[model samples]
Target: MASSRGGSGAVGRANELEKMSIEQLKALKEQADMEVNLLQDSLSNIRTATSRLENATTALNDLSLCPQGLLLQTLSLSVWVPRKSKKL
Candidate 1:
């Protein structure tokens, strides 16, 4: 792939830096700095996406407990409420 070729090309350049002219070295350093910035931005986006997925999962789990809670409340009310007795 192109990415693999680019990775090897940078490794090859590392070995040839001493032979390069000052202008070429400066340009190479600038390119490397830009790549570092791009990778940092990508990592930040991934972290934000992961946090959002975790929050969504927690909300879904809480919603699933709602029915059980309502059933408990109804059962407790029926058991605790007393009926009036009729006189014979």
Candidate 2:
């Protein structure tokens, strides 16, 4: 019957494991801090890259209008010619 009623000692042993070592806690905190710093650095780099891309997109849009400007210049080349042989 000892094997059928021996779960209380296991529970008491589990309660003893509730207190963690200071070194383990410190290591966990340091790892969390490092992750936070790395994420902040990544976010900063992303902001920088996004700002540069926005500037490049704006420059591309401004340069794309060049062809339209040339089209306006070409409109002056159309000249009306009168035909002398018109039967009207």
| Number of the top TM-score candidate | 1
lDDT of 2 at 86: 36
Q: In terms of lDDT, which candidate is strongest? A: 1
In candidate 2, which residue pairs clash?
none
Tens digit per residue, CA lDDT, model 1, 1-88: 9999999999997879978999999999999999999999999999998998887788567657665423322235223222344569
- Candidate 2 segments whose C-alpha is farther than 4 A from its true place: 1-18, 67-88
Clashing pairs in 1: none
lDDT of each: 0.74, 0.66
Each candidate structure's TM-score, on Cα atoms with residue i matched to residue i, is: 0.59, 0.54
State the lDDT of candidate 2 residue by residue for 24-71, as single tens digits.
678877999999999999999999999989877875675576544232
